[model samples]
Target: MDASFDALLDEAAGAPVDGWDFSWLDGRATEQRPSWGYQRLLGERLSAATAALDLQTGGGEVLAGAGPKNFPPTLAATEGWPPNAARATRLLHPLGAALVTHQQGTQLPFCDGAFDLVTSRHPIAVQWPEIARVLTPGGSYFAQHVGGRSNVELTAYFLGPFEVGDSREPEVESAQARAAGLEIVQCRNERLRLEFFDVGAVVWFLRKVVWAVPDFTVERYRERLRELHDHIAREGAFVSTTSRTLIEARKPAP
Candidate 1:
């Protein structure tokens, strides 16, 4: 039998959201993967690098998934959120990677030209200058960034109509990288499908990805959640779009 709305809500709300893992939502929601196979590509790059750094490495999930055997001689990751940082430390230390607790928007705590490769998956914000500063000559930065207007439909649903911003645009990011003295080697963007099988999935998602609905709360958004629940009941699922960008930049050799 299908679970009740309240039951689903309680289950999702109580589910632990530690780390970057989304296994809890496995059967409740689905999102399409990019064609570039970021984790695989990351593993390949890590294999060739002598020293590597992963910025905003949420819970070190992706880094660890890239295979510790593929890790460079020197591997390090930075995460800002305390809970995530603690979780990442536990997961990454055993893999021989050091975890640095770092807040976003601050300067990276690494020496200049310290790493041959830098990578991230869906970093909240890219510190272009810091990235350039930390990369050795001829080093590269590879990452799959969350593009602008990502999940705008889902965000707009709870907040009402809003103006879309140009933040996270690939062209804008490429320009910023160039201004930071890195040459853009590759840039690609894709819009993918996302679906929520139930309101519980939506609740868990908003709770996990707090930025989606900055002020989300069951008491605050209960009415809207109920409306969405009905809509999904009639429509089978609540559909949305997600944007992603694959970007690669290289520092000059000279």
Candidate 2:
């Protein structure tokens, strides 16, 4: 871990992510199919047309899922977390995806019009214009990001005094993309529901699934989890909701 990231991590430590994180989803963020979801957005057509550059590539799950052989041999991923970079590389090495590189999301080190496609999955540090600047004029951009106004009920329950959700509206992000000179192709805001066996289970899932949380105390979370379990067991199930957005945009065709 970079010592610089220590302050960032500290600032976010145990803090509930207004955005998205693995801690909240419990290893199930990508496990479920959207019957009508963005898998279609990341379709063979997009892959075929794109020499993709994945930004903020996490554990390399997105990289592998996108089919390394189908995309450009030079298809690359950017990651700043050394641990995440190492883990992603090791995880995708078998797929011939050693193409991953270490970099930050805010600053892409590529030239103007360097790629045909760029993808990000709910980046904690969103720098869309920087991402737009490196893409080919006719290229496209795709992302599956956490929607603003998500997880209100659960967040309110768990962190009573705190504002639990970040207001990243799809319209706002899409508008920003447009302002950056990227044309909006398609945008979808979908609601996802998660059920916790109990409150502790929910906290554990949130910590792992929604890695965006910066302020968390195991004991505090556990106590709330216990209360939640009792309440849910007596009721039926605890329902937590999240709104996710899938965005597709394009640079003007050259």
Candidate 3:
């Protein structure tokens, strides 16, 4: 939540233009079923939850997937970017939802014990205590994120270490969640393959999908683009990237 993060968010939000609409990514991933390893891991528990909170509601795929909310538990969508908020509105409102833009820093605006389930897909992974503070007793938090140094080898092989930047370390994230009084309910992790047509698509995706552009400038972006092109020509038509860590933890019952 600093200027660096703001810059990354600004660049990171540039996905729709890059062939990354829900249907493109989610639709295809849905068919793979294997790519859905994240959802499959948490599906049953999430489906049964009443109130739900989706933090960092990027494209709100999880929000859309949460299904018809008849069972009631104050479902809320918390997002960051202004455009994403609008998009989430379009995606979630029809399902009877109006999302709130979450205020950054360490404070979450909701009252303590306000939700029965919390979910996020590679959200910044900050504000664990805030998440815990808002969860109702016996609540659960489900998240799928880029684990720390999680996919370094693939990244370095393709574009070098400096080009790969993300903030998801299982130890750090889970530790914070546990410190906030949540139990390690379940964890599922695997090296997965998400394909792009070529390195241009891969570069674009690293900028958007993985949020790993590492805060460069116009000139630097060009340099990185060239580097990615060179690597692709040398390696092959596609690049393989790996991300791990999908976890569900539970808040202790009061």
* 190-248: candidate 1 lDDT, tens digit per residue: 99999999999999999988988999998899879888988999999999999999999
- Residues 114-160, candidate 2, lDDT per residue (tens digit)? 88888877676568788789889988888888787566666677666
- The prediction achieving the highest lDDT against the true structure is 1
In model 2, the runs with Cα more than 4 Å from the true position are 1-35, 43-46, 98-105, 161-167, 209-213
Better of 1 and 3 by lDDT: 1
**Candidate lDDT (C-alpha), each:** 0.94, 0.66, 0.62
| Lowest-sum lDDT 10-residue window in model 1 | 1-10
Q: How many residue pairs clash in each candidate?
A: 0, 30, 3
Model 1 TM: 0.98
| Runs of candidate 3 exceeding 4 Å displacement | 1-36, 40-43, 69-73, 150-167, 217-219
Residue 6 lDDT, candidate 1, scale 0-100: 81
Cα lDDT tens digits for candidate 3, 54-91: 78877666657646533244577888778777788778
Weakest ten-residue segment in model 3 by summed lDDT: 24-33
Model 2 earns a TM-score of: 0.78
Most accurate candidate by TM-score: 1
